[model samples]
Target: MKRPHLIVDDEIAVQELVGHWAFRAHTTPIQIFNRATDPFLPGVKTHLFRSLEALDGRGFRNPVLVITRWKIEPSDVDRLEALTNLKLTILVTWSGIDDDRVEPVSSAIAVGSLEVLANSASRVKKILYWRPIISGLNDTNDHFASARRLSEFADATVFTGLFYREEIRAYFREAGVPDLYADVARRKILPRDAERRILSHFEGRPIFRKTSCGVAFAHGVPDFNGHFGIREICDICPEAQHEICGRKHHRPDMEVVRSLARVVSLADLDGIEISDRRIEVSGSSEAQRYFMQHALNFQVHDRAQPHRQHRHGRAEIGWE
Candidate 1:
């Protein structure tokens, strides 16, 4: 089994990515804590915390691939770094050249968090810079400035193409950022020229471009061992860099299935069959189908397991 992917953010999409990777890696499901309602699967090696504050009281022994946003403070990072066993990767998104011009969602305070991580004693393994392309707003010369600034700190940068969503459209209008928001109000994909122009800014920088979530930035982690959904484009996924899927078969470990079965039963799911490395749920309700599908695809750790209970001292405990 490989190191478990530890996701520390609240983004459902990112949580799902790590969960998918856990199944593909044939390891325990990604342990996630978004500071919200508890995630499914409470008996296996997977875990979901009520909040980021809960982690201060817990410890992990395995070399976990820690994926988190740059929202944590230096003090929090210091404590996390104290756990020498875990590997850390910080993800941050920016739109403007600096904090002052960026959106409140990507503000100076948020950028300060990145700086805090960089200065912290934790020695973060990787820093992935994310730039969500927004036309006229961040797609101008300002994009180059942001990319250049990113090169100063990040190991790699991922440029995510913007998509049209009602919330996003409404956000730009409500935020009072003109032109750019209106430009993207109806459009989804960033124009080819705009993408090229933004990308060109990082031409000579150490931080190169790969359009994706931060996963493509991982250096030691195997790409095939994980999964990316529609975001699994060649330029973004490191697995595509080596062609792991074509060369090797990625079969789910039966133990993972068995572990997930416990979650299935707990979810009150019936008509679920596990065989031949495949899970089939017959004549199930929509909620049951959703439960079973997510359970199988993600980590299913038992938070109530005595061994995984909170420990304050240096005695590192395994999530398993």
Candidate 2:
């Protein structure tokens, strides 16, 4: 029985999207925001609540991995801490250093939320998410400045390449918002120079790279999710890496990976030590499918095994 991962997103849709990924990973996906559902995999129990208050009513017996955004207040941290059975992880997605650069990523809430969360005495882990590194737009030296300044506030910084999806572009078009995807004509890979530029911003701070932004600090299949477990590309944030990321039961499935590596096109495995069960896999949707498929196969064999897995060390992907 893997520890249940509690998904806490204000948007039920986002929770469901990521929750389904966790579900496919064989990790328990517990919803913190209540929403009506259609049907999920059989024998999988689905838990939903109208609010955190509703969840609180049902006391947690096992230690839970509580996942939420950094746009939260210290009081929210306090409330989470009160749930002694829960371990907290907050993912911060805003990279605007100051007010001038804040507009694009700003929610209805104000910027500088990370600072407030940092100053609190609570033990929640913070992850700086510099995702969607839009080329020529938000990808600049200012990115480094913002990351350097906020790096102290977070437990680790995870940077990901920007890829455009048709559904998202269609939504932006329908919503009348300028699509950033149009800037690059919907390129799939994050520009290598842009990735380096963002990595440069984390000088003296712990940093890790992944295929998708915001994948760190959450529970799922790392290889499939496009999170290769090595900080070799960027300097590791020492202080932040030490913070507990609440993933104790999840471990990588080396045998499955070795088998998959032989059959699949893992271009990034060069010079990597797979015998240790650690390899740098290129971030691709096909790889994720392989990982997810392995996990599904386990369910057929024995639901208890739950299939494949992957994780990190200090400079590693930063999973607990």
Candidate 3:
């Protein structure tokens, strides 16, 4: 039996992890769609529906859809059902809204409002919601009823404390709302230890905490047998410099990153050999170019090798 296929449309890093996992599972074509112009677009939904329908019609029964915090409308749901003729599994970041005080009906109602078209045709199975007790937002009583309602209606519930609070706060600060951090810092939703446990559960491995740019980050345990590090594109093509790196240097494209993340996660779970053939990097673009040329000089060097030892630490990858 081959491993199931996962389609991920989130961050590049996440796609990489999922791809790594898929490769280990003996799944073919661990693909990533990071280039999706607008995941929520009606056109994208039609594209997915058509693609999934074609695959299912062609006997690809083992398929799974993995989305990260992307909202779906009701019309999209209807189209998906019409195409695939199967229930869809959805993963959502419940932390975006207050889950403690809102009733399930309220949450469902909110979703229904947003998904009027899709909701009319499809149903949601295995909804994983992560709830974190924010410091100042610890008053669960405010939203507990609604959350419980949603949980009861959900097929499967995976609860986690708020793991992205610091990241969210950092984003706000960078967007010129640093003071919002103060308010968030005062919440008492999920304690640091509990948050660690929640992350470990989904990752199925140990979790490490790191601080970067005044934000707290969590790194999942390395999937040693899966792709674990960034594949700096510069290492493979010295002249492929792009503006993405803010310099005349090449950087790993979004699709590559997503593919690696998926493969790593699947590999970690199934215990398979992780591909280490990724680009190497130095401190700066100039340094990276130098290293790329140096690596290419070796007669046996393929420019891409399984440099497993140089994988990114958790904070750098931002799984937390």
The parts of candidate 1 lying over 4 Å away from their true place are: 1-73, 84-87, 97-102, 121-123, 175-188, 204-213, 224-232, 236-320
Q: Report the number of the highest-lDDT candidate.
A: 1
Candidate 1 versus the native: TM-score? 0.50
TM-scores of the models, in the order given = 0.50, 0.51, 0.39
Q: List ranges where model 3 is wrong by over 4 Å.
A: 1-38, 68-75, 82-87, 96-110, 113-128, 131-133, 161-169, 176-320
Pairs with steric clashes in candidate 1: 29-299, 42-302, 43-302, 44-301, 44-302, 45-301, 46-301
lDDT, candidate 1, 29-112, per-residue tens: 233432332222232113422322233233322223344333555556665565442334455555553423234344454467
Residue range 1-320, candidate 2, lDDT tens digits: 13344445434643454455334322332333212321111211233212333333344321123332325555555655554332334556654433333233352222355676677735555566655555555667866676667667766666654445677666556666566543432334455566556656666665666422223333222222322222342134343332322122133465655455544454444422332223334443443434433442221111222223422211111121
Give each model's whole-structure lDDT.
0.42, 0.42, 0.34
What's the best-to-worst order under TM-score?
2, 1, 3
Each candidate's number of clashing pairs is 7, 6, 58
Model 1 lDDT, residue 52, Cα? 23
Of the two candidates 2 and 3, the one with more favorable lDDT, higher being better, is 2
Whichever of 1 and 2 has more lDDT, that candidate is: 1
Pairs with steric clashes in candidate 2: 144-201, 155-240, 206-236, 206-237, 224-288, 252-309
All-Cα superposition RMSD per candidate: 14.0, 11.4, 16.0
